[model samples]
Each structure stands twice: as structure tokens, then as C-alpha cells.
Target: MSSLSKLAYYLLHNHSRIAANLVEQGIKEMNIKIPDEEKDHAVCVYETFFQFMGDSLEQETNEIPSKLIEWSKKNAEGQIFSGGKISEIIIRYPVTRKIFADLSTQWAEEFSLTNKESIKILQKMNAMLDVSEVETVFAFEKLTKQMKKDYQKELDTLSNPIVPLKEGIAVLPLVGTIDSYRVNHLMEKVIPEIAHLNLNYVIVDFSGVQTFDETTASYLQQIGSVLRLLGIRTILTGISPQLAQIAVAIGAEFHDVTSYTNVKQALENI
Candidate 1:
């Protein structure tokens, strides 16, 4: 029983018309009715409830717990006007908070998510309130698993950071989302592979990639940039027009990257 709820109870029960008239007049709460000593205790109860309602409405958007007991002690003659009447009032307020709480709990349980995931869910809901995309939500879950697997592979590759290719020619397969994490791993793995295999050329195959975005294009450029510095030629394969468009859009410098459509084509040219 929060003060806001208590206040709402009294407002609706006693001055029910006040709620309607307030909406008409754009008034959140009516003026408080302070009771005279000669008047009935019911009058005092109503006055106290009115004032409390106003104050509760004032603090509507905040999450502060109600200091209602302290308030009742200071304002009313006998701390709080408690009886069967007041008990009935306690159960009378709107059940909006209950509804919202249930909705939130449902979403949390559905996702089995916490903290950042909750924030992301809230943000997505806020952004796409009307445009319900069920498939997009399903895709996000699937991609989350793929992203986790990609991250694990990155960690393992970083531990060794170098894979020797057949006949001392290394093949560094670039797959999944190519964010900064993958680019950093590429830097770590590239030079070591070049040195360990005594390789003159490293074939960076992008054939298995499902999507090509600017981030991935930039990462490819970064790989080529570093490999050139290590005195190793980087032969990029599977450069789709979409990939090239992304590279152009981001102004990714791919001048030195000798590209082929696939590994066999790259090998023939090398």
C-alpha cells in the first residue's frame, strides 16, 4: 500500500466526480478540504486523503517509496484514520502497476535474459512499438548464438594466433561478423602466420560470409594493410559487388589487396 495507491483509493471512493471533473478541467487533484474541529471525523478523513492525493500526483513519475506513515502522523489527529472504511479504500485504486509488472515479468522470463539484455529489449520495444517484426526477434536470438561461437573461435585463434598453411602458404578464413574484435584477432594471427609458414602470400577467403557490411569491408582493408607491412601479399577472394559497394561507401582503402572470386582462382593467379 503505497501513498500514491492510498491517495488514489480515497480520490475515487469519496470524490468520484472529482476524478472526472479534474480530467475535464485538466486538474490532477482538487484543492484540499481541511476539516474544522466541530465537523465529523469523516470530513477530516476526506481532507487528509485529498491533500495526500495531490502530493502523490505531484510525485507520479518518480520511483521514491511513499513516506505515508510519517505524513499521516504529522497531518492527521490520530496518526491514520484506519477502520473497515480505510481497509476498503486500500483495495480500491487502479491496478495499472500490477499490469505493467506482470508484462515486464513475462518478457524477462520469455528471454531468460538479464541487465543489458533487458535494456536492449526495452530499447527495441520503444523503437519498434507498432512495427512488430517477429522474424527479426527470432533472427536476433539465432545470431546471438552464432556471435558467441565466433567469439570463442576468435579467442582460440588468438591463443595460437597463427595457423600454418599447406606448402608454407597460409589460408586465414574470415567468417561471421567482422567487427573490431575480429580485426584485432586478424592482426594478431596474420603476422605470426606469415613468419611461421615463411609465406610470401596469405589468402584471405571470404567465401562463407553471408553478409557484407561496411564494418566487414573495413576489417578486410585492415588485414590487407597489415599484411603488406609484414612483407606478405594478401590475396582477397569472394569479393561480391555488395562487398565492393560497402567498401566504397565507407571509403575503405583496398588498393593493395589483390582479389579473386575464390581460393582456386587466387591460387592460379599466385
Candidate 2:
């Protein structure tokens, strides 16, 4: 067999040992510790990586193995789910790359491979690592974005909650700074939820609100209009002087809606 073929054969046969050695050397060089239980899994990952490397060398192709790409995405998802930072995995890459390069050179020497052949192997290894890194980062970003969206949806549901006061009365206590996002959330989600409650009255209390602006006043007017159309009486409570001025400035007429000083008074009157 040719020297290149022999080298490929050796790599395929010794991949497990090479992977173990790489892991051991990597941990020591990076001064990082892996838990005893996790050590086996780490070695297994490296073993699969090395096996794929051998396959690439044997085929003389630069194309990365599909198994490795799938593994990278799955690993990224696992890191996110386990509350582990992607940086933790990324920080070790430089050292890992160095170790792999050194091992490739050592193997080339041992097998008496030509410099051209050595460079080919090293280039293929680097290409595979690059693909793995990109796949991992892409997966991490996609999953993190989805998680944030889901978390915001949950917060919106909690923030705009409709607390039933009585048989036909409910309160929507607006807290925090009012923004366009919150207003849109109310228009889309809260309005439908309120409609389903069969409530005759809804107290929109703005006492806990930190700031009121012209935009918020307009949104409030819109909400009041929708509630009125549903035959639900709208009660405005906790309207500070500042909020009242802003509503008037924005031309948000509340003449048809009932006004009260606070929730207790609104409840008493209702």
C-alpha cells in the first residue's frame, strides 16, 4: 500500500487513542477541569471527531462529515439547555486547534508522509473545525433568540393579566413604563383575553404607571374604544394630573368612559 494509504489506515485504527490523548493534553494545557462523569462524554465527542477526520483523509475530500455538523448543532443546544456558556466551549478552541495541529505533524513524521500530504491533512482538519464552530454559533444564536421571544411572551401574559374583581368586573392594573410594545401587546393579546372573560366592566388602573405620554394616551383611547364596542363599560382609575394633561393634549376624549380616583372607589361605585 502507498504511504498515504498506510497513514489513513493507521489514523482510522488509532483514532480512539488519539482522541483520548488529545483530550488529556488539551485539559492539561488549558488548565481546565472536566467532571468525572462528563469526562467520558468529552472523550467520546473527540473520538467521533477524529474518526470523521480519518474518513476525510481517506477520501481525500475537504467536505466535512454530516455527522460532525449534526453533532455540533446538538452540542450547542445542549449547552444552552444546560445553562452553559458558549464561550466556555469557544475559549478552549485555540488550544484545541494547536493540539490537533501538533498531533497531525507528529503523525506525519511517524508515518514518513510527504510535506504536501501533511499539509493536506492539516488543511482538512482546520476546515472541519471551522465548519463545526460556525454551525455551533449559528445554532446557539437561533435557539437563544427563540428563548427570548418565548420569555417575552410569558412576561407579556403576566404583565397584562386581568384580575376578576367580581362576577362582571375585572381590573387591568397598568404598571411600569408604558411603551409601544406593551400597548401593541395589549391590543393583540389582552383585548382578546378580556373579550373572552364576559366582563361587563374593566377597570384600567394607571396608578402604578411610572410615566404617561401622548402615545400612551392615544393607545388608552384605542383600548377604551374597543372595550366600548364590546358593550363593556370602561372605568379609568388612578389618573394622575400629569396623565390627565397628557390625555387632553393628545385629544384622547374619555367623556363616554367613567373616571374614578382609585380601584377601591371604582369597585365601590360598580
Best by TM-score: 2
Q: Provide C-alpha RMSD values for all models, in order.
A: 20.3, 2.7
Model 2: CA > 4 A from native: 211-217, 240-256
**Model 1 lDDT per residue over 55-81, tens place:** 444444322222323322233223122
Pairs with backbone N, CA or C atoms under 3 Å apart (clashes), candidate 2: none
Writing each residue's lDDT as its tens digit, candidate 2 over 1-270 gives 876788778778987898788888988998988786656666777777777776766776666677778878877898899999999878877887898789778978888888988888788788878988899999999999999999988888888899999999999999888888889999999999999999999999999888767787778789998999998999989989987777778777789888999999999998
What ranges in model 1 sit over 4 Å off? 1-166, 212-216
* Model 1 global lDDT (CA atoms, 0 to 1): 0.51
C-alpha local distance difference test of each model: 0.51, 0.85
Residue 258 Cα positional deviation in candidate 2, in Å, after optimal superposition: 4.0
How does residue 111 of candidate 1 score in lDDT?
41
Candidate 1, residue 38: how far the Cα is off, in Å: 64
